[model samples]
Target: MSTSDPYVDLRSRAFAIAYQMLGSVGEAEDVMQEAFLRLHRTQRDGETIASPRAYIATLVTRLAIDQWRSARARREQYVGEWLPEPLAADPSPGEHAETADSLSLAVLVLLETLTPQQRAAFLLREVFDYPYTEVAEIIGTDVDTTRHLVARARRRVRERRPRYHATRQQQRRLAGRFFAAVEHGDLPALEELLAQDVAMHGDGGGRVPALGRPLNGRQPVARVLAAMAPLLARAGGVRFDLTKVNGQPGALVFDTRGLLVAVMALDITDGHIQTIHSIVNPDKLQHFGRVGNLGDLVRADPDPTGDA
Candidate 1:
């Protein structure tokens, strides 16, 4: 790869599209590598490329759609709730609000409801600001068909997307208060930070114990957290570090040995926590660093004396 090659500069943009389309960093990276390889081969064969950007984007979109189709069956058989692999950083923060929101774990989860072609069209048109004609070219559909795909996807997303959006500063502050309440086992404070219909989702991939279904309602969610606070403390060597996950206020949990054990992303709205997404599946945490055996943490012995 030459430093002067435009592909070098387009890597990040290409990654943003691939990641959003596939919702898996590893898979998106694989798509990028393959796309670049093809590009290199074509150039080496003395082919004249008019627009490297559009050409690469088309390659990435098509490749990601294929990957998504193949992965569908595996995801269908996955144990427990399924969540997109959490992204540790925002790909492009200066982009428009729609692009930023599209990166959220919440939105990505909702995007799973659409067909692969619909998802590609929607992301290209709505999030990346691609025109319908270009989106049609990328997805290999007629312009009218592409418009229909985008409209249908937009409708589906609108029905499920978060109604309220929070600023980064607000998310950090609320997340701090929410986590503090959890750490201290303050039931009232925890409940105060959550909305009336708040929900908590956990994805353990059947390797560790997790909520088989989303736990809903503020009181139920708060009670569970309060009960787990002492258990987590008793587990010993557990640490929680505040950080960003999927462009939202979240935390990275580590064991005594400093291995990542889990990730938690919060969805805040109207100055309250609306949803909590927790990923404890070891397979998903490998990208972060070494992963600890979460089962050990979850299996910690409780106080035998009727006090716990």
Candidate 2:
């Protein structure tokens, strides 16, 4: 790679690496900005860096690790479950240079369980294709140790990662079915699509009332969905626009006014809905564009007379 293109061509690549490491668009962007400042300072100070791309990657990686540590603390005290801010990802086919191969909403949630160093090591080596030697230097460890960290991280993640038994189209079909079931309050239908031990998570961040703990099991999860479904029409009208939430089949919910409301992503395992990741946190949603008040799901009835 040419030195000059590092500033322009590698911009998106930098964001991809940071996003994979930090899992927050806002924070990743911030890391990139800080990295730009550092690069400028180095250049202005008459420093001669051999490779701008590697230098920027190193800067972003270290910064991201710091951000992850800081954010992890706040997340521990977050009002409710904390989910990575969702993004509408562009279509990526084949082994694209920017492919965060296993990066998804659910996978990121799993990544959260890995120690920051382990996560950093795994991402640097596995996702970004950084050589083990470079990965070690980036995370400040020996090459052999970095290899072990990546191996251990991979093992831990594999133990928790979903088998991905369903194709994108199949997953989308299931998502559509589940959304429809919720919209119409079809409890039986909801149950049919959910895995026996399906899990549901909601992130309202206390700005809105949301379940703090995950709801597990098909029956309980289904019941909650049936109850929450009314929140849709209660908004008078809402749009469930199909979107790829973190590279998975998901939707961008909008109220009647065309404002983004909730961003939902699903994990489908064995052809059944296994997990639902819902982000209603206004703070998080603010970066998600626009959304309506989820608290209003109770007041407005989708159909008061029970005619529909």
Candidate 3:
């Protein structure tokens, strides 16, 4: 929107590229700014960019891959389960509706299983529809290698991804029921709503009270939820807002004080909750405004009332 900025026109695409690669809003915005700086310097130095879009795209892709690789080590050593930062909704880019399939929390988590080159290759070719030749050029690999990277990454994602992603309406009904059972401490009803092998993943990021490991099976998960129901009744009880999270049907958790306390995303299959991702990291809630610290809630309640 700034005519004074030379890279203004390419900003959206640059953001899209960086976001898809880094899977973090803060880092994506930062990488895009770096891309713009480089673009400005190049043009200011009397260099004519024959294809500014490609040039910027390539720049952002490379930068994001570098950051992602470096961050991978830190991520692996992170205290608890790591979930991608949740975005409330897709941001608009003028009139064109930007596709957000790859930007979802689910897909981004799957992308983490990939190597940086594989992620870059797959996103460029599969998600962005870039040509193999161009993807290779951008990734600094051969065309065949780029094609192989995309193929390998795609296969792993397909195999690990949920069999079905329920409709938003279905998700709303399901989430409503899931938490209702929790509020009522009805373990049987809640367990029935989940798949037999359902697994719940909580990401407290070692900064909050969360399940230290993935809880597997319906019975165990249900029992834990039932036990925590009372604690969730703090203040005015936990309120659930059926909202879009990273382009998927998810819910935001707010305490009685109207502060966002958690981000909950469910992967549904066959009308059943397959996986529940509970993100309670305060660091991941900056977008939700000033949220109360998890420590405060733990100290105050210290009771059983948790949600994912």
Candidate 4:
């Protein structure tokens, strides 16, 4: 089997770029297909591409940029909240570091704020470590413009980022405490774990009775949790399973009937859970069959194993 293709090794990389840019597996796969088509059509013309991987990357980025623009418009028309698509675990630990670091859930969600060019430039430089000149070529822009775009994008990210420095260790700890509070239905414990200005947002698309708008302030969040306690107690012995959503610590819950119920994600700031994103809308939980890990489960219900 002699194949004249160097890009066989690059599909995952191309897919990664598209997924980060478009936030949809289907869209990413479509963009990658288009990129490969372009390569097949252009390579036969005796065009000398230094790196097939880089060439394909440019094509995927362009396609994803267009898709992102349209998606943003659709999100604006959405009935309620809009959320980033969730991702499952890699299952392969060897590839984990690359996928985990590049697709940090919070970072991907934040990248939604950038313009296509800004996002391409910033991600290439920051995530891929590409030089300005190289990134300029990848994005089909001049180096000066690419530099400026990356700079502006970086500044915007810094400004919008939570005040506390985010680290995997701190996120793990906060997730642990969150599970403890939810399991016990302790408002004070829950309140103490959340920042005073903590907020929770969910994009269940009106199917689930979410807060509709972002729940701000610890008091309001506490009240909501308290109100849900009886329902959680009565809801067919539901259990939470800790999982990673989009590579961040989160949870997925299932009722006793073995039906998926909720997907919860969080953003930790200053050692407290600053944002609690609970996705109770059933329509959105179709792709994910299970939570990412134990942290992901416990956040949804106290019993992740569904044995309770």
Go through the candidates in order and give each one's C-alpha lDDT. 0.86, 0.79, 0.79, 0.72
Q: TM-score for every candidate vs. truth?
A: 0.93, 0.89, 0.87, 0.81
Tell how far residue 87 is off in model 2, in angstroms: 1.5
lDDT of 1 by residue, 1-308 (tens): 65585566688878888888887889999999999999899999999999999999999999999999988888999888998889877656468778777888999999999999999999999988999999999999999999999999999999899855777788889998988887778999999999999988888888767777788999989988777777777777477799888878889888888989889999999999999998988888889989986667757643211221
lDDT of 2 by residue, 1-308 (tens): 55565467567767877887777889999999899899999999999989888898889989998998998888889886777887876435644533533667778888888988898898878777899999898889999999999999999988887766787789789889988787788999999999999988888777767777788999988887787666665557566787778777788877777777688888888989888988876677777666677656555543222322
Where does the lowest 10-residue lDDT sum fall in candidate 4? Answer: 290-299
The TM-score of candidate 3 is: 0.87
TM-score-based ranking: 1, 2, 3, 4
Better of 2 and 4 by TM-score: 2
Q: How accurate locally is residue 38 in candidate 1, as Cα lDDT from 0 to 100?
A: 93
Please name the candidate that would achieve the greatest lDDT relative to the true structure.
Answer: 1
lDDT by residue (27-108, candidate 4, tens digit) is 7888999899888888788787778877887888888888889988888887567766666553235454534655655667
Best by TM-score: 1
Clashing pairs in 3: 228-304, 228-305, 231-304, 232-305
For candidate 2, the per-residue lDDT at 236 reads 75
